[model samples]
Structures are given as C-alpha cells and as structure tokens.
Target: MAKVQVTSADKTKINTYTFFLVSRMDAGKKYYVVSELEHLTLEADSSKVSRDGQFVGKLVPESGYELPQNITIEYGSDVQKVSGNLYSSVTGEINLKASWHMLIRAKGVKASDFFVADHVKYQITSSENVAVVGTDVEDNATWTVTDCIIPATVSKDGKNYQVTELGEEAFIGCKKLKSITLPAGLTTIGERCFAGCVSTLTEMHCLNPVPAAFPQLFFHDTMEELNNSSPVYDCVLYVPAGSKAQYAQAEGWKNFGGILEDGEIIEPVVGETTDSTMTITCNAFEQATGYIVKVYEDAAKTRLKDEYQFDADGKLRSSSFSFTIKGLSAGQTYYIETMAVREGYYPTPIIISQNTIEAKTTGTATANEGVTADKPIVCVQDGEVVVRSSGEISVRIYDLSGQSIVAGKVTGYGSFQLTKGMYIVVAGDESYKVVIR
Candidate 1:
C-alpha cells in the first residue's frame, strides 16, 4: 500500500495529520485510475476527531497536487471502518478521492436521439465533447436488453466521449433490467430512475467505487412513503473491494439485500450510526445547503415517530454531525432511514438501522387523535409512567407488537407505577417508548 498525507481539522484547535485510501480500481494496483478513485476512502488518524467533526480543514496535497471541491475524502469515524463521505469522519480513518469533472455535455442526453454502438444505445449531449445518457419515456422498446454494460467511452459520429450522467428515469419501469454495469464517470441518476424495478434488478456492477450521488426510487413518492413498502434495495449493489462502506453511505446507496464489495456481502450499507443517532458526513459537507433526517418505526413505517431537520447554517457542525432521535415506542425499534434524496441536496445517506438512543426529557403531547396538547403529556420517570394533560385525556401502554399491555385514564394528571423494564406509553395522540429503572 502506498501512503498520502493531508492535514486534519480539530474542534477547538489547528492541527495537521495524514489520511489514506480504502479502495482502488483494480486488484494489485499501486496507482489509482482517477475515475475509479472518485469515491475512494481517505483514512484518518484513528485517535483523531475533526475540529468540526471532519479532518479536511487544511487537507490539501502534502507537497503539490490539489484537493478539488468535487473530490471527496471518506474515513471511518470509528474503528468499525464505517466511513463518512467527503472526508466526513468523526473517528477511525478513510479517504475519498475525486477527479476532474466530465464537463457539461456529459450531464444528460435524450434517448430519442439514441445512437447504437456495440449493442448499446448512445447519444451525445452535444458539442461539449462528451456522450451522455438520459431518459424521458425511455424507449426501451427500441433496444431490449436484460443485461447491459455501459462502456467508459462511447463512439458517436466518428468521435468518442466518456459516459457520465445516467439520466432521470433511465429505466423507470424496465422489468427486464436484471443487471447493469455503470461506468466510473456516472455522476447523476435522475429522479425515479428505477421507479418500478426494485425486484428485478438482481445485480449492479458499478465500476466507480464512489461517485457524486445515487437517487434510486421506486413507485413511491418519498422515501418515507417507500419505507412503508420496501425499506431497502432488494438487489445486491456490487462495487470495488474495500469501498463497501463508502458506497453504503453514498446518497440512496443503502440496500437491505446488501452492498457487495468484490463479491463479499456487507448488509445494510450506511454511514456512522449509534444507538439513538444517525450521522451524515461528507467531503462536500460544507457545500450542503441543509439536511433533513426522518426516522421510522421498524414495523408499519407509516407511523412516524419523529423528525429532525437542519439547514447548512453557520450553526451546523463543520465535518460531520449526528441526529439524536427521540420518542421511542415500547418494544418498538426505529430505523434511522432516509428519504430518496436528490444528489444536489446532500452527498450521502445516513447509517440506516435500529435506533437505540433514549430520551429522558418530555416532548409535546399528542392526543389519541394526534391533537397537540400544550401542557404536560407523557414521560417515564421514577419507576413509573406519568401522564399529564390540560383537559380530559387517557393513556395506554402497549408492548412492541402494538398489543395493549396496560391502560390508564386521567383527566388532569396521573402516574402509573411500573417495574424495571421498558414500556410504550401513549398519552392522547402522542406516544413514547421509555425505560424505567
């Protein structure tokens, strides 16, 4: 393995450190193919935390080279090797390397103007010197392919250009799309790109270990809506070995079936996550306008537990930040899932998994009908379940399965003593799963 040096950013002080890469384009390779290195991991000092939860403050080339804005550096915020995108690690070590942009003509191309080359359809995005791929009603009828490989460069009009953006709805409803080979330069995948092929896509061979973003949505409108049906990409997403973690955290990259790196399976690819929080980090963290974090219940996701959203105001953390989820349902597990976000919004996906973080403070109360209560609501404290409301109200205790374990009625205030354990208490419309010791 070769070594590279970059500076680090600490929370309250200025310090310099080194980082390394996690994956390469080919096996036994010492140098990186710039295209394949786009999302390569940049390892950080394990004993390091960013001055702003990131290490890219002064992270420039050790001697010369430039760290372009498009380039990303990912590192594990912890020893687990779960890398944060765009040098967005809070711990551990990972590096993200991006190369030059493919230019405008590489953005999107229409299928109606398709050009055929090597049994694959192609279209030039124009005189910008590159070929692009895009779709509107994707005339898959003209070219029916069950398995497809998009070459790094396609020939058109006696000229060759690199393949970049995979246009919006590239294969919106292509049921026969069993597998696809995306080139290393694919940066943008338009909305609803894979609208209805969640089941048929068995394998995805992505030459790029990491790119700018990925936005794969099915028939559902939003991620939460999709969560109500399918929580992850059923197909296995294959990428370069050692780059699984970066792919996992890239926008809309988490798939329940698995994100495969060099044939090995890594289930539920996600960013850094803890019991009660999911963190979103990236080299482009500074460029993000803002972010939205929504959490859903493990079962019947329609029931939204709570949400946290923030804009990229000056108050935001510099490197990476974590969302502390609240309102735990008794016996209920919350998955810190993300909505299918667009590429321009943010760079990566949150570590989607079970939320184990607990909240001790009380939150706004909701009645059985979801009506807000301004006064006291419900909370678990002093080995008991406390319910308070300004008007007539009731409380019910349910287990993880939604089966009512106990019930209580109260008009003003009531406290039900409890044993040592956890319970889901619903006061009015608001519900909270809490622990009492």
Candidate 2:
C-alpha cells in the first residue's frame, strides 16, 4: 500500500499546524478516494503557488513503484483511502487544486483637487490646459487668443502673433466689435459663432489668407456690405486692395460684391416722369425696337390715342406726336394714362398723367337767345337732345319733371335734334323752357 500525508503550514509560526492522511491505495492497481481538508500545504516551495491557493505540480511516488489503478481524488472533511493493484516498476504523480483571497488598495490624488475658475476668458493650450483671466465679460462679445500652441513662433516684424484655429464663437454676436485682427495661421472658424452680429464688426483684418470655408455669415470687406438687402445702410467693407475679384467669387462673401475702387460708382435707374404734357423721361429706358406708346382716357373706354414709336435713341420728340382729346366738354375733368408698347412684349406703362387738367370753353355767350324746344315731354334716348340756339353757345337739356334729360355736352351754333319732349334748356347757368317735336 501507498500512503500520502497532508499538512497545513502557518507562516506566523513557520511550522505545520495540522496533519492528516491525504490518500492510500494498494500497490500495482488504481483506486479512487474523496476527502475534504482546509488549509493544506504541500512539501514543495509554497511561493510558486498562486494567492488563490491553487497548486500545480506532479506528485511522484517511490521509484520502481506503479501508481494505484482506479484512483479518484476529492476534497471534504476527512482524508480517504481506496485499494487497487499497483506495478512495482512504474512511477505515478498527483496534483491538487485550491484558492486564496486577497485585498487591493488605491493610490495617489483625486480629480476634484484641481480647480478652475468660472465665467472668465480662457486661453486653452494645445494640451487642453485652461487658464482663466477675469469675469467682467462683455455680453455677446468674443475675444481671440493668438499663438495658442505652446512654443509659438514670431514673424520677422515681431509684431504679430500666429494661431492655427479660431476658437469656437470667439467673436460671435459682438454687437460692438468694430474691428478684429486675425492671426495668419488661422485655418477654420466655428459655426453659429457669429450670427446676429450685423450691427457690430465693421471691419475684419485677415493677416493670413482666409480659409476656403470661411463662414458665409461673416460680413468681411466687400461692396455688398454697403449694398446689403437691409434698408438701413451703415457700414463699408474694406478688403485687401487686390482681393476684390477673389472675394467676389467666394460663396457667402459674394453678397458684398467686390470691394469698391475709386471712380467706380454706378448711377441708379431713374423712374419715368409724369406731367400734363404726357411726356416721360426715364434714363434707363431702352429704345424698344418695334414698340409703340399708347395713351388712354380710361381702361373702360375703347377710345385710345394714336400710337407713337420711339426713335433709335429712345427719345420721344415732342413733335413726333400730340394727343388732342376731342369730345371733351368744357369745365369737365378727365384722366389720362400712357404706356409703352411693343408687339409680343408688354412692359409696365408709364402713367403720363392721372386725373389731370380740366377742359374749359374758349368763348362765353348770352342766355335763352339760342334756346328752343318743339315738344314738352322729353323722352330720354342715347343721351342726345334738340334745341334751336341763336349765336354760338353751349346747351344742356332737362325733362319737364325737372330731371336731367340729356347728359350729353354740346357747344357752338347748332340745331339740337332730341327725342320728342318738353325740356328746360340750361346754357351756362341760364334756364329756358323749350319743346322738341
């Protein structure tokens, strides 16, 4: 039979505290045994074992002896033994498993120990270290810190600082920012950073070339700055003298057109004039080819003035045509409107005159001397009347019931033929009874 010993060692005493039979078996055959023991130690070097108490090693039996057959090992309260034949010429080995428990401790300082001030301008370095200056910040104002990277370089002039990035919203909404000096190394601007800043930032100095994606909202120097859609014109854009063409092609910056140079002012288009003579002069008016000018008393009236064509120079010579408004009664008001016309093309018409000049008679006359009515009851028809007048004069007719019969206006010597009726004839404020048959 073969016998195995189990022991528990205490490091404090440097000696074994418990001992028991670990396993037993008959020589030359295999056997199985199960046992449970705590705090067991092997004769091998203990330091090689893990802190979890697991053991990995071969257990060798005496030389020239075979391991027991049918052998099984387990752990519990007592050591166990099983029998089986073992060969004397064979050697055998065994292994055990166990575990150990341990505790861990933390090292060094906490994050909260490092503090940063609130509500102040900070110049963050490439390493992300932040330094606060003060808290008196201007509302909606942006400030840029140049040469942000540590170990920054200086220009030959030694007067300017270079930076690689425009900090987020560095100059956004600075309603009072009249000017800004940008570093040459700047490559990109952040978003929504400069909106609502139209009132401020009259000028921006780009010491370096502007980045390709320079923000569109940034109103840099250009003519569009002065001609912006806003009804209020307040500022002028000034760009590098020779950069007008390049900036004009830039996307958002193009809104300010190119920078204005000396003697490059463009005059505005003048509107057409409206006067009693029905004459108009628009400086921008082009000499419309095959175009005609039309004048009308009113849209509802089919009557139209003669059409007149413009000369090659677009000048409508006063003698080219004259509008004589006939069928107009003295002391009567009339409206006149004029329009430019071309076949297949209709531009806005120029209102030569609206609600203009009164038509007045040239001569005066006496009353009743030229009035006659053959019949008493005046029948209204197509607004005409008949009356016998002595000498050149004007005539108006009214029915017997005192209602105006003929609203037609007339002047000069004439025998007025009207529908049969008795009517009151009125000539320039003088009334006379007459009959038309």
The per-model lDDT (C-alpha) reads 0.47, 0.33
- TM per prediction: 0.33, 0.24
Q: Report the C-alpha displacement of residue 271, candidate 2, in angstroms.
A: 33
CA error at residue 390 for candidate 2, angstroms? 86
Best-fitting candidate, scored by lDDT: 1
List where candidate 1 sits over 4 angstroms from the true fold. 1-114, 118-120, 126-143, 216-227, 263-437
Candidate 2 segments whose C-alpha is farther than 4 A from its true place: 1-122, 125-138, 141-161, 210-212, 216-235, 257-437
Give the alpha carbon lDDT tens digit for every residue of 278-306 in model 2: 22222111212222434444445456644
Q: 104 in model 2: Cα distance from truth in Å?
A: 32
TM-score of model 1 (CA atoms):
0.33
- Tens-digit lDDT track of model 1 for 1-437: 33334343332222234333334532332222111122122334444432222232223222222222133222222112111232211121234232211100001113334666655544555553333333323354344568878788876667777887664445656777788888887766655556666666667788887754655453333566576664655565668756778877766676434564543311111233333333332211322345555566544557666776666555454544444444444333344443222122113432211222211222323312111234334654345776656577678897666788778678866888877655788777777766554
- The candidate that wins on TM-score is 1
lDDT of 2: 0.33
